[model samples]
Target: MVLYLQIIWLYLPIGLANIFASLSRHIFPNWDYPLDLGKNYRGQRVLGSHKTWRGLIVGILAAFLFFLAQKYFFNHYQSVRDFSLIDYNSVNILTGFLMGFGAIFGDALKSFFKRQKNIPPGQPWFPFDQLDFVVGGALLSWPLVPVSGVVILVAIVLGLLFHLLFKLIGYLCRVDKTMI
Candidate 1:
């Protein structure tokens, strides 16, 4: 029970980061990105251009805070019920930053691939784009959290479903102009 609770708590930063990043779109209205597929790298900004520095900073900060919380909580108990997973320092601030950065990097990488493929920004590309950030974030945080294969499978299935549902909600809310 404690382990599960701890795991859920670890995701708080990630959730908060997403919320902060979403706010960035409205906060930085001047950030206009042209969805040009034909355009080559040309040493120019692509993929991650839509990702604001402010968002990154906020997201990282949120992750760091969450990590601190987790660390404090763990240090208080020093044991996770019957599990010893808490024996490691996986819940540190550094781990939180890694997870946050990993997730954002994955999203940015997906955007880059989408542009290269001319899939259009915000268009839903099955598997790759949808799971990119989750996979990246998970990979980054995996070293810290010793989640089992079953946990990973659960995460993947639930994450994908949640992604679709959120996209649908965003569309219905008219926040997402694209139906993808």
Candidate 2:
């Protein structure tokens, strides 16, 4: 039970980053973070429009802060005596940033496919759209802390389910028009 909780805790920052990215429009209306793909198959934006410099910055900052707090809290409590499993405080920050960037990158890749398919942004696109960010985030950070195969498999399944649940709630609350 405790190990499960610990694993969940490890994944929390990236999940929060995803939630923030989803809500970024409302959070920073002035940014005009291009959700629509620009006409030109230009240098940078070629990747995807939704994946903006602003979103990347915001995501990285959020992840960094979250990890910093988690590290600070863990240090203060000294609860996890077996500290070998966890990395140093600096490592947490680095890994958190990677997770954040990778998550946004994954979402952008999915958005690219969505545009290619002419699928509207908010429309549902099944497991690919749902799990992309989580997979990217986990993969980016996996080297830092190699988890069990069971954990990786569980993360993929759980991430998809969580995405569906969040989308349902968002639609019901009028936070989003649809789930994708």
Candidate 3:
């Protein structure tokens, strides 16, 4: 539908950055480094052991490459270019690169808070689990892309739905240990 295309075109680059961070755990499990450096503040891990340097690297790299590819095609194809909300051809490449870092770091931040609250890993945290990366990605990339508020809101709604769907699929397929 027209709405679907518009929402996706507007949010795809940023969404990809966040999505790739979740995938990075599977792509390079060995590269995970605890962002907290295994130190606990008041008895809880800062960001936990799951937030790793490798995951950050993979997340940023994947998003940067995806953004570059989109930029290339948008520059070449009229159709692709027309659908883009953010100017791929002229926007800052750092926005795209930062998406990856932003998404992962966002989740890491959430993990820190979750730890503080004594929430266990892989546990369902309702919409928080779904929206963290989207919020993080959008906030970090906003300076460069500068999209409208409506776009971000719609993207958040879509992010929530997609997160639920993907988590369900992952659980059913045995790829994820928990279903949100």
**Winning candidate number (lDDT):** 3
Return the TM-score for each candidate structure: 0.72, 0.82, 0.91
**Model 3 clash number:** 1
Where in model 2 is the C-alpha error above 4 Å? 33-49, 80-92
Considering lDDT, which of the candidate structures 1 and 2 is the better prediction for this target?
2
The C-alpha stretches of model 1 lying farther than 4 A from their native spots are 1-8, 28-45, 73-90, 178-180
Every candidate's CA RMSD: 4.5, 3.3, 1.7
Q: How do the residues 118-146 of candidate 3 rate in per-residue lDDT, one tens digit apiece?
A: 88877888878898887887778777876
Please write out the lDDT profile of model 2 over residues 1-180, one tens digit for every residue: 666566667776778777677667667867755644464343333445565656766776787677777777766766642432464453546887887877887787787777677766566788788898888888888887567767766777778887888888988999778754
**For model 1, where is the 10-residue window of minimal lDDT?**
79-88
Task: Report the alpha-carbon TM-score of model 2 versus the true structure.
Answer: 0.82
Best candidate per TM-score, number? 3
Worst 10 residues of 2 by lDDT: 39-48
Please give, for residues 25-95, the per-residue lDDT of candidate 1 as tens digits. 67766654433333557444466345666666666676677667666666676454234444435444577
Deviation of model 3 at 41, angstroms: 1.5
